[model samples]
Target: MTLALPPLVDHHCHGVLRRSPDADTFTSHLTESDAPAAPGTSFFDTQLGFAVRRWCPPLLGLDPHCPPERYLERRRELGADEATRRLLRASGTGTYLVDTGLPGDLTGPAELAELGGGEAHAIVRLESLAERTADASHGPEAFVEVLDHAVAAATRTAAGFKSIAAYRYGLGLDPEPPTAAEVHAAAARWLDGRTPGERLTDPVLLRHLLWSAVRTGLPLQLHTGFGDPDLRLDRCDPLLLTDFVRAVAPYGCPLVLLHGYPYHRHAAYLANVFTHVYADVGLALSHTGARAEAVLAEALELTPFGKLLYSSDAFGLPELYVVGARVFEEALTRLLDAWTASGAWSGPDGERVAHLLAAGNARRLYGLGPDPS
Candidate 1:
């Protein structure tokens, strides 16, 4: 039987390209690797490519499982604007919480909402806010005052805040909040030495960004488990964040761990133990594609149903929107349907849980209400 879930709440995702991409340009964005593809092999041979061909082609007016070349040809036929609209509409997303942190000439929340026919909200990236704040400040003391005010202002109306300290200093840094002196000295040193518009990599400023975000009482989405090559995989473990989790508990903010492929189980364990902690199997589902069922099952093993949120983590390609949705719809239906078949879960329970994974849980977590429909 089918899951028949609600309109999905894509709690984390990025915008699609402004212009249609050539086949090679599109294939290149399919992996987390920064280096060129291994000799003759392609990122397209993976689950991500297969899923995109199988699910996204019909939206561009071709049959499922079409050749990559044919799919690209059809996508180009429809033009970029129409192709994006068709794909986003086909993804069944009801609301989007977009991260505009990554520098790209891509759509913002408002443009995404218009193209997709859904509600859209912003998630302020703490690191981006800090780097921008630093660009305007002359010294350490000025940086502190400006960043503090920026974090407060950014989170006031946003769904929440996000961080990539996992990419910068790694998650293994000291968990406690740093002193004002440490923040000032660190900011001064980094700013004085660097040229303008560099990325935020200073550990002290990262800690300050995190703690300041926690104080806002907004949900904090932390990238964990896996990402681009800049991250040290061993250091990205959610277990490394235990002290930091304890430190932020008093602030009454929710911690949402994003990605979590190899470490998804560890993220589940954190969610099971902490009241304010939650885990999102976003990029994992899209990256694993056809093999996503086992991964989804692993994510659900130790996670409370209410704490498991849905997201696409799709970037650059419109095909990712459909692939992310299809993988989720298929995997979730199979998992819960099997449980109900064995009498481990009731039919109604399965339906309710599937709904929570789709939209209900996110609604409660981010405080989004009933579907506008």
Candidate 2:
């Protein structure tokens, strides 16, 4: 089916530096070295270089020796290239909502803008407290400092700034998870009196942030469901967001649920019931399973057309955009075909579904001016 809609948007991702030539060589060497080796030793060796090992056991013999900074450096190296663009085109994406994990210098934004052909909606990540303290314990003050730098950097960048608070679950450098109270306290300090709700992250800090961001008329994106396997599936449940949604309802901040995963149904339910909550059917539909079509159909059953949006959450692999787009199209096709056979939607209705899933909903949610025909 031909997709006539705005480009797909990936709402969440880490724009950390890509692997350097040396790092690349190292990885290649490791791969080659372990190719004929025993599986246990190979796995252990690779695990040592991953950040996830902070929470879970390393795979094989790979030690989690590489620091988060190294990871970021590698991401930077990979993010700037034609490879990502090729992936986007292959995946049928025109617009990308690029999220640079942590706020740094305008280096990434400037580079992305150039690569995106001068047009890109960049959701710059401001204040990644979890990443900053991943390797060491930090006081609330340290969190504040990171926020300050992020805010200042955002003010300087041409790209739009979206605050990403707390890396709750097990995503940070610290061995322990951050508490709701700690998240709120740190947010309060960083926000300093500015509007709050315009950023994305955990729900614990939503009320204040939403209230603040709403005052400025900016929308907020909430990361829901699963992404990192290190996090408990229970913590990623969208159902737990009931109170968080209620608290922000009156504020009128547009709440975008990023990566609504295992709880795609519940995420859709919230989008269906709440005017403020919008479900982004991106990562889950792309990465999880071949049953993404079925899952998306279920989500749409509960979600209103206007409350749905598309995103890729493309990171790690630039080809992810293309991969995600292909999956989205495949899933969407299966859904429409089934709906048509079931008499829920006719041929014409299927076309409308195509338009809605492709671009209509995102346009409405982001309030992007009249369709860019």
Candidate 3:
């Protein structure tokens, strides 16, 4: 179905780099060399971005000799051009949020700005203190430095920072999994040090960071629901955030729930109940099997009007934008059709729904102009 909606916004995407043309050759070499599979996995799945943590090596065309920074640097050297821009436009994405690679890779932001030419919107990823060290024993001093650097980078680029309080396990620089004490310690450190107007890791950190941001009235985005399969499903349960939502009900700042995957219904429930919490239908109806019409209908039934935002989370392949947009349109068409047949919504209401789903909600939420361009 053709959707008569505003240009779609891919609020979360990582299209800053394209896969190398020599991916197959590189994969073969890696398999033949010392980089064996991380147990129980085949070489083919490894090459196809199956294992989340190890996925970046092939996509960035990294040689074992090169560090990740250098690999991303090579991607920047290739850069986004007219053909890449065409690919994005054809994919039906008008705006995207590009994670500026990892810490110290601000080149992604420059590349996106050059490519966009002020025609599209982009949000650059800033490094968080949590990403600084894999170990938590180093103390909060280093973390404080990382946060300062992140704020400085965001200030320099007119971009926002992305933070993560806890990954699969612990915090700190150690590759070893983090313990519960480490997680709590890291959270406490972030809460104590963060100032007003700083970008947060995600809404899960809201309870700790909210009071600080609320004191400063800075906006915060929360990564809700599912993301890379490496993450445990239970950790992403939206219901786990009920206490968090209740805690910050008093001091308000715009809280965007990123992803909202399997928990779309729950996310919508929170959106309906809280003025500050809004559900972003970023990766949900796209990467996940939740894109079916029935899922969309259920989400719309649960979601209040104007609480939904569009996002792509388009990392790896740029084609994800088109794939995601098509899915969004299909699901939305089914929802409107069902609503119309039941006399629950009319043509005008459908038009409004389309507008809200497309850009109206995001424009208002992010305080963006009518035309992001």
- Give the best candidate by lDDT: 1
Residues 297-347, model 2: lDDT tens digits: 877889887677777665554434444566677778877777788897888
Give the CA lDDT, 0 to 100, for residue 211 in model 3: 36
How well is each residue in 1-373 modelled by candidate 3, as lDDT tens digits? Answer: 2467767665555643433334443333222234555666544443222222132333334543354346435545655453345445555555555555343322363455355342344443333333433133244555544544444445443333343332332122132234435545665655565554344453333333333333333345666666544455667666666665665666665666777667788888888888887776656565443334655666776778788777766554443454466667767887887778799888788888787877777777655668544
- Model 1, stretches more than 4 Å misplaced? none
Backbone collision count in every prediction?
Answer: 0, 39, 18
Off by over 4 Å in 2: 1-3, 11-82, 102-110, 116-118, 129-166, 169-211
RMSD of 2: 10.6
Model 2 error, position 53 (Å): 27
lDDT of 2: 0.53
Per-residue lDDT of candidate 1, residues 216-278 (tens digit): 898999999889999899889998999899888888999999988799999999999999999
| Top candidate, metric TM-score | 1
Provide the lowest-lDDT 10-residue window in model 3: 46-55
Please give the RMSD to the true structure for each candidate, in Å. 1.0, 10.6, 9.7
Residue 10 lDDT in candidate 3: 55
